[model samples]
Target: MSAAVHSERPALLVTAADLAPQALALLRDFDVVYAGKSPSDDDIARLCKTHNPEAIIVRYGKIGAQAMDAAPALRVISKHGSGTDTIDKVAAQARHIEVRAAVGANAAAVAEQALALLLACAKSVPHLNTRMHAGHWDKASHKSVELAGRTIGLVGLGAIGQRFARMALAMDMRVLGYDPYARDVPPGIEVVNDLDTVWREADAISLHCPLTEDNRGLINRDTLARCKRGVIVVNTARGGLIDEAALLDAIQSGQVSSAGLDSFADEPMAGGHPFQGHERIVLSPHIGGVTSDAYVKMGVASTENVLAVLRA
Candidate 1:
């Protein structure tokens, strides 16, 4: 594509610095603007004002009312992944702008990550690995928890949750799920209507829910207190779902034996954050759904979502 030809196309702003080539091919008719990684609300608003894009693809950063108001031509906001909490839906609706998400596009990757985290927490993988690396092998004293025949409670039985349940069942584990909105839940998953049952019964708890006003800090001090003592916790979902301070306290007090976290209350989890260097907690940089395959899937899904509205 010639620079002159590209400049003549309708503009599309992407929050991320880069996009997959496969997804870019679908945007041939649009001139895409890359908002460098970690773009602030001010940067996004400035870009929207300068570019006057017809659509925005949200992959990172918060998309607030200011950004929406700046782009008078903006008609849609498409999420590059399933989570849409970062985008201001109320503001978009008020502005008559449509919001769409690449729902389930990254399900497999995130589900697999949840399972990995569960196993890491249950079997003490990181701790053992670190010990071995430091030339301190205490194989005789180390006792790993076995998952077979143990109950695993899952919150939010969406695509990702259901996928993780299937994996857990294959490993000879009991699967209990809690999701009021889920319908036709596959066989073998014991769906419990009450979250209290999940907290009391499960040996391990995994979160696969989205972040919302009603469910923010769902795993706070009170909820943690209700959980079975020494329970393993894994969260590949939104960080707001869990209270970071409560989780740390639970770990320190032995209410939660171990935790595997892929997301945080804040992204790029600031330097010297409390979660840093915690032995019982294993952390990942919110990349549970960031696999290469998931990247392309999410990118394509987000691009298609934008086109659905723009070309309607």
Candidate 2:
């Protein structure tokens, strides 16, 4: 028999940075290799060759074919969040590597943030807070619309989107969903065939789609023009789906009333970004899935996937 088929136990590599205490405890059970904050492809290659990990659990970084080539024995890869755009899934599948992620681990956190943004946009939250803190009582600027009896158009109706739909329904809001692959619409949601109709009809629009070449910058000037005037937008999913330049222009021109963004086109966003001082946009450093519960759930799921592949 060849040496390629002789390895017995599987080693695992974990490239996540600053793991919570509970996550660390669970990950410690495996024969694991670690790396600094953002390990380069070469660094990852070196580590994989040295450890020969059968599984790798990574977060928020690219894992291309080169990285996978470095570990000939790797059988599985686990992502810490729902978004898998960071990893090359096609390459992994070609290598017989099973890729898995915590599908709904951060659904509640994301839904909460979406609601917060919707309410803030409807009621002018940041604006009023600023005035109150500056010792000015201005009720005029605080006049806002209620969330009840409004339509919310959700682009993707996956796990997180379903959760948001339920929440919106509970708040007495009409939910409209547009997902080409969605098999069934929830009890309260109205499923639409095309996206342009949702863009024109919804009072608020929240995106939950993956970032792919087909949908990159889908929300451009033309789409913005189709959206209802003063439509509030929220994005807890990938950043490239919406054209940032078009969005900024809409916000300035009173087309897009407000936006809540958890992810950006470029993460660790550059220092002097235009949206930094904009009160109409609420930004949260890509922390939609950073809660302790999500961390534990992801750690457990990833560890389970690793162990399954190792035993196989």
Query: What is the per-residue lDDT of model 1 for residues 140-245, given as tens digits with 9 covering 90 to 100?
Result: 9989999999999999999899999999999999999999899989999999999999999999999998889999999999989999999999999999999999
Per-residue accuracy of model 2 over 179-232 as CA lDDT, tens digit each = 998876678889999998898899999988778999999888999999999999
Worst 10 residues of 1 by lDDT: 1-10
Q: What does candidate 2 score on TM?
A: 0.92
TM-score of each: 0.97, 0.92
RMSD to true structure for each model, in Å: 2.1, 4.1
Q: Point out where model 1 deviates above 4 Å.
A: 1-6
- The superposed Cα distance between candidate 2 and the true structure at residue 22, in angstroms, equals 5.4
Model number with the top TM-score: 1
- Least well predicted 10-residue stretch by lDDT in candidate 2: 1-10
